[model samples]
Target: MSGDNPVDRPNGDDDNERPEQSKGGDENNPFAAMFGGASTEQFAQMLQGFAQAMSSPSSGPVNWDLAKQTARQTVSAAGDSSVLDRDKRELADAIRLADHWLDDVSSLPAGCSKVEAWSKAEWVEATLPTWSRLCDPVVARMAEGMAAAIPEEMRQSAGPLLGMVRQMGGVMFGSQVGQAVGGLAGEVLGASDIGLPLASPGTAALLPANVRAFGGGLGLSEDDVRLYLALREAAHQRLFVHAPWLPARLLGAVEEYAKGIDVDTSRLESLVGQLDLTNPEALQNALSEGLFDGDEIANTPAQQAALRRLETLLALVEGWVDTVVTAATDGRMPSALSLAEAVRRRRATGGPAERTLATLVGLELRPRRMREAADLWKRLTDARGVEGRDALWAHPDLLPDADDLENPEPFITGASELAEFSDLSQLGWDTSDPPVEGTPDDNAPEANGPDSPGNDDAGPADGESPDGPDGPDGGEPGTDRP
Candidate 1:
C-alpha cells in the first residue's frame, strides 16, 4: 500500500524531482535579472537583508542613522580633511575677538557662549537635527500621499506588503536627504552661514576648511577673511539670541509651508504606477531627480504664501546681519567692503548644495530681498539710532512686514511713531479713548478769539501783537495798529 501511495513514498520518483522544481522556481522568478541571476539561497538572503533594513527601528519617514552614514561617506568622498588643532584655535580666537568688536556696534549682548572649529562631517552631524525638522514635514506629507494613493482594494489585498513599501520610501528619502546635507556640509562656512540657526543656541561653529576655500581666490589674507566671517557669524548669533522669537518663527514658517504641501495626485499616481518594486534603485534615482516635485504641485497658493513669508523673514534677518557686520567691521577691517560684496555674490549665486536643497524641499533658502532688507536696516539705523532700530526686534509684530521691504522709508519714518504708540500703550494709555475736551491736541487748529495769543483781532496792530517787537519795516511800536 505504501508503494502505491505517491504521497507516502519519499524514495519514489517525486523525491527525485525536487531539485528540478527548485531550479524551475528560480528560472521563473521575476526578480532574477535584478539580482543578476542570483541563486535561490542568495535571493533569500537579499530579501532577508532588505527586510532587516525595512524593519530597522530607526526607519520612519527617514532613517537618520543611514542619513548620517551617507553624509559621512559623502564628506569622505569629497576629500574633506579633519579640523586641525591650529585651525580650531585660530577660529576660536577670531570668533572671540569678533564678538568683542560686535559689542561696540550692536545693542544686543554677546550671543556666542562657545566658539569652535568643525570638520565637514561635524557640521553635518551638528546640523542634522535641524535638517530633520525642516525635512520631516515634506517627507511625511509625501509618505501619507503615497499610502493614500494606493487603491483601497489593492491596499487591503497587499496587507503587510504595504508597510514594506513605506519602509522603502523611508530608505529612499533618507538617501536623498543625506546627499543634500552632505553637499551642504562641504559648502557652509559656519553653523549660521545659511541665515538659519542650524546649530545649538549660543554655539558658534566655523568650518575652517570651507572658510579657507572661500578666501582662496579673494586675494585677501587668511586672517582678514576669517575675522570678517567670524564677525558675520557672531552678529548672527547675537540677533538669534536677542530675538528669542526668531528661531521658532523661522522654523515654524518652514513647517507651515510643508504642512500645506499638496501633491499632484495624478502625477504621483503615474509615477507610482510606473515604479518597479523589484528594482528599488530606480525609485531612489527618481527621487533624487525630484519625482515628487512638479510645477503643478509646487505652485499652490498656500505654498506660495508660506514661501513668501519665509523668504521675507530670511531676507530681513540676513539684511540685519549684513548691516551689523558692516558697521562692526567698517573702519576696523580694510577688506570689509570686499568681503561684503563677496558674501552678496556668494548668496545670490548659491552653491550646488543650495540648489540640491531647493530641489529636495521646494524652498529656495536664498534671500531674494536681502539687499533691500539691508538697505532698510541701514536707513532705519540712520533714522532711529541703534536703540530704536534694535527695539524693532522686541516682538515679531514690531518687525517690518513684507510690504515695508518694498519701500522702507514709510516704515523707517513711522518707526518712531510706532514706538511712541507702543510706549504709550505700555504706560496704560487707552488709545481707543476719545480725546478729552480740555487737552490740547497738536493736530487741532488753534481757535481764534480775543484771548488767543495769535489772534489778529486782539493784536496791537494788523501785523503785530501787543508784545511783539518792531516790525521789519521799523514802524513805530503802536503806529502799526489797525
Candidate 2:
C-alpha cells in the first residue's frame, strides 16, 4: 500500500507495462497522446473528473440545458431586446390580416392559433425543443460511432472511462448546437423561415427585431416588412396545420439521414488522436471545426436519398410559401415584389447563422431548387387552381419529386396520378364541406379589417385555440396532427 496501488493499473500490470499500439502506429491510438501516452495517473485523474461529471447525467443525448443557456447568452450578447406588448399586438394583427388574405389564394385555412412576437432569445427558447428532436438522432449516433471506434486494446486499457466518452460527446454536441441556434436566432424571422416547422405545429411566431433588420437595407417601411413576413409565417402555418403528415415527413427525413450516417473509423481515430482533452473548451472548439464536416463523413446511398427527400420537401415548402405570400400580398402591398425579391436573395445567399447551422447538421437547408419548385407550384395552381395545388399536401405521395421540379408540366397537366381523381375527396381532400370556424370561407362576408369579429378581435374560443391545449389541430378540419 505504501508503494504503488495495484488497483490503479489495468490487470495489476507493472508500472513499465504498455498497451500495444495499432500497426498503423500512435495515430491509430487517438487517446495515446490525448492521455499523456495513456498513463495510469492521467487515466485516474480523467476518471475522477468524469465521475464528477456523471453525477448529473440527466441530460440525455445533448445537454439541452447548456444549449438553451448558451443560446440565451449568445443572443443577449448580440443585443436581444424583450418583445413589448405593442409588438405582440402588431404582429398578431398582421398575422390575422395575412391569414384573411391567404384564404382567397390558398386552400389551407387559418393555421396559427397562438401568435406572438419573439425576441432573439425567446426564439431560441421556443425553437430549442424542435432542434433537440432534429439533432438528437444524429448526435446519439455520432457518440455511439465514436465510442465504438475505440481500439479494442485501448478499450480494455481505458476501462469504464471509455463508456463515459458519450457524455463528453453530449457536451460537445450541445455546445455546437447552442452556438448554431443562437446564430440562427439572429437570422430567422419566424419559426418557419428555414422551411421547416421549428416551433409547435400551430404556433406562429416572428422575431420583430430580425424582421426590421431584414428590411433595413431594402428601404421598405418596417410595417410593410412585418406584414410580408407575417404573410409568409401564416402561409407556413396553413400547411403545418392542415397537412398533419408534413412535420413528421420533413423531420423523419433528417432522422433517416442520421440513420445512414457512415462514421469513418479512421477519422474518429484521427480525431481521438488529435483531441486535446486537457481543456474542455478545446473539445467544444473541435466540434465547431466540423466533426462531421465535408469529406469527413462518407455519405452512403441511403443518406444521399434521405438528403434528396429532405431537400425536395424543403424546396416544396419554400416554394409554396413564396407563391402563397406573393399572391396574398401582391396589389395589396405595394412593396410585395420588392419584398419577395429580398426574401429570395436572403434565402439564396443564406446568413452566417444559417451557414453555422448547416455545418452543425452536416446539411445546408438552401432549398437549392426553390425557384424551380415555386414555378412548379405556380404551374399547378394555373392548371388545377389553388384547391388542387393545396390538395397535394394532403398526402406526401402527391407532392412533386425532384424530377418534377425540373419538368413539372407532366405533373401539372394530366400526366401524373392526380389526374385519376375526379375530385380531391377521392384523395382524402373534402371539398364539399364548408371550412370550419376560423378558416377563411370564400362565400362568407369578408372581414373589413383585422379588428373585425372572428379575426384578432375575438380571443381563443372556450379558453382554447383551434389547435391549442387539447392537441395540435384539435378543432380544425382534416386529419389531426399525429
Candidate 3:
C-alpha cells in the first residue's frame, strides 16, 4: 500500500482545492480575488507568520510523507534504485584493497570507515540526515522572512493554512531534492566525490553499476575505474575519520552563510501566488529564472571569510585525495591519467546530485577552490613530507586558508626539516626550486602577520619555524591540534 499521507500534488502545487476552479468572486478561495482585486501579499504574510509560529522550537521541517513520496517516485523513475547483492561484495573487496594500499603510502590510521555498496535508493535514504542538517538553516531564514510579513487579520482568521504551506514547501523541496539525487545515484563514483563526507565516516560505499556506467562515457575499463574510484573514496574516508573537526567545520560554514541570506518578500509573494501545484520542476525553474527573484545571495563580509575558508578546506580535501590516490596507483593502474582527467571534468560540469543539492539549499559543491587547494597541498607535502603535511589536519588552526593556497611554499616549509631529508629530492615532489635557506617564509607575501585562524598556514613549516605543532606553547585557539 502507498504511504497514507502522500503529497496532494507531485508537480508544482500552488492551486487551492475547491470545487469551483473559476477565478470568480469566491469567498472560499483567498486566491480567487488575486486576478484584479486586492493583493495576495496579505495571504502570503499570514502563511509566513504561521511558518514562524510552527518553527518556534519547531520539531520538524516538512511533512515526512512528501519526502517519502517524492523519494519513491524518483526511485521509480531511475528504475535501478536497488543495490544488487553481487555489487555489494565487489565494493567491499575493492575498498579492502584500497585500505591496504593506502596504509603503505600515508600515516593515516587503517580501516576506519566500514565499506558498503549501496543501491541508488539506499544512498538517498542514508544521506538525507546530513542534507537536512546542511540545508535547514537557510530554509529557516526563508521561512522567517515569509512569516514576518503576515498581516494581523490573517493570523486571526486562517493562520493554520500558513503553517501548512511552509510544511508543504519543505516536502516540495525535499521531493525535488530526492528526484534530483535519485537521478544522480546511477552517476556518482563514490560518496565523497561531492567534497563532503556524504557517507558515514569510516565507511566506504560505492555503486558498482554506477561506477561502471560512469566509466562507460570514457573508454576506460570497469576494473581500472573501480580501482581508481576506490582509492579516492578510501583517501577521503581517511581524512574525515582522522580529522575529527572537519565534518563539523565544513557543515558549520555552510549554515553560517545560509543564515545571512536576505530574501525579498515581494518576489516570494509573486512566486508563491503563481506556483503551479503539479509542476515541481517548473517551480524550481521559476526560482532560478528570477520569477520569485531576490537580490544575489553570495557572501557577506562574514560570508566572504566563511566562504573562502570553506573553499580552501574543500580544495585541500580534493588536493589531498588527488595526490594520495595518484601516488597509490602510481604504475599500478594503466588508466590513471585518463581517469583523473575524467573526474576533473565531471566535477567541473557537476553531476545531478550536486545540482540537486544546489537547488535544495543555495550551496554548490563543485569545489571551485580544488585546483588552488591541490597546489597548496602538493607544495606543503613537497616541503615537509607526508606526515608533516597530514599533521596540519590535527588542528583547524594549522590548516591553510585561500591566501596560503596561493603561496603554499612558506606555510609548508616553515615546519619542514630539510636537514632531516637527503635534500629536496627526498621530498619527491617537484614543483619549483627550493626556497633560500635561512630566508623568512611568508604565506601572506607582503603581510607582516598571520591570517585568521591562521587559515593560510599551507606552507610546510621550516624545521626551525615556531609555526610547527605547538607543544603547549602555541598562541592560537586551535593551536593544540595534532
Candidate 4:
C-alpha cells in the first residue's frame, strides 16, 4: 500500500509521479496564463469575452454600444430632462415663424419640413449616426498606426495579444467620443448649431433646455432667443437644401483631412509599455482616461491643405447663415444685434463642448474667418442683389476661396464676369470659346438652379489655380478616401 501511494515518494521519486506533477504545474506558465489558464474551456471563454466586447451593438472601428451607453450616462449625470410638450409646441411655432421670416431674406425656399424639440439625451442618440460616419475613418487609421508603431518583433511575440491591443484602442476611442458628444449635447442650441447638418435633412431640431440656459445670461426673453436661433437653423436648412452638394462637400473635406493623420509613435510606444497584459481591465481603465487622443496627431502637409479647404467651406456656410439670419431678424427682434454678438463671441472663444470635440477629433468646425466671410457675403448681396449673390452655389467654380475672404473688393468687382462664366458652364458650352452673339437656343435645356454641371472638364476660373482647390496632385475637393 505504501509503494502504491504517490505522496510517499522520497528522494528516489517515481518517474510517473514526477511527470504528472510537472504537467500539472505547466498549466500556470506565463503563456498559458496569458490565454486565461491552460484548460481548453478557459481559452474558449477568453475568446468569447473578446468577441462579445467587440461585436456588441455594432462592430467596426468603434464600439458604438459602449459609446452610446457612456453618452447617456454622462447626460444623465448632468441632469438631462425630457422635452416637455410645451417645449415642443413653442419650438415648432418658433421654427414656423422663422421659416416665414426667412422667405423674405433668403433666395431659397423654406426647408424646415419638421421641427423637433429634443432633450440632451435625445440629442446624443439622434446625432450618433452622423458622428459614426465622421469619426470611423480617423479612428481606424489611428488604430492601424498604433499597431504599426509597435516593433515587428514585439508584434510577432505578442501574437494573439495584438487583437487585445486593437480592441483596447476601440474602447478608448469610443469612450472619448461619448464624453465629447455628451458635453456637446448641453452646448448645442439646435441640430445645426455648429454649422453642420447633424440631423436628418429638412428636420430642424432645437433643445429647448439648452436654449433657455443660453438665454439666461443675455437678459433677453426666452421667446426672443428661441426665435433668433430658429432663424439660424431655418437659414442653414435652406442653404443645405438649395445646394444639395454642400453637405457632402463639408463632410468630405473632413474625411480627406482625416486621411492625412499621422499618429505619434513615441506616445504610442509609451502606451504600449504601460499595457498590463495580465490585467486587461486595469489597462482599459487607464487608456479610457485618454492616453490616446488628438494631441498625438502630427500635422502633415496633406492635412494642412485639406484643413485650408475645410476652413474655407465652413466659413462660407456659417457666414451665409449669419448674413441671412441677421437680415431676417434686424428690424423684428429687438435683441437681434445683441443675440448675434453673443453668438459671435461664443464661436470665437468656443464652448466647452466644442473645445472637447476639437481635442478629441483634431478638427474644429468653427470658421476662423467667419466675420470676414460674412462681410464678403454682405458685399455680394449689396453688389449683385440676393439672387445674384446666391447664384454662386450654381457650381463650385464660382464659390469664393480663402483669398476672396481677405479682399472682397476683387471678387465683388469681378462678380458679373464670374456669374457669366458659371452660367455658361452650366449650359455645357465651353467658357474658353464665347458663344455667338445671337438669339438663345430654345432647344437647349434651361439653366436650372444650382445643379452641378454635368460636364467633367469645365474650365477653371481666371487666376484660379490650375491644380484645383488644394494642389496639383491633390485629390478633388471633398473626395472620399479610397
Tally clashes: model 2. 1
Superposition TM-score, candidate 1 onto the true structure: 0.74
User: Which regions of candidate 3 fall more than 4 Å away from where they truly are?
Assistant: 1-58, 269-294, 352-368, 415-482
Q: Tens digits of per-residue lDDT for model 1 on 413-470?
A: 7626445633423532222322234554332223211112322243343333454332
TM-score of each: 0.74, 0.75, 0.70, 0.74
lDDT of each: 0.63, 0.64, 0.55, 0.63
Model 3 — which ten-residue stretch has the worst lDDT? 443-452
* lDDT (tens digit, per residue) of candidate 3 on 231-342: 8888887777666456656665666666667666767565655656456455444444332132355534544444545555676778888988877888778789999888
Models ranked on lDDT: 2, 4, 1, 3
Instruction: State the lDDT of candidate 2 residue by residue for 247-272, as single tens digits.
Output: 75677566666777766666677767
Which RMSD does model 2 reach against the true structure?
A: 16.0
Select the stronger candidate by lDDT from 1 and 2: 2
lDDT of 2: 0.64
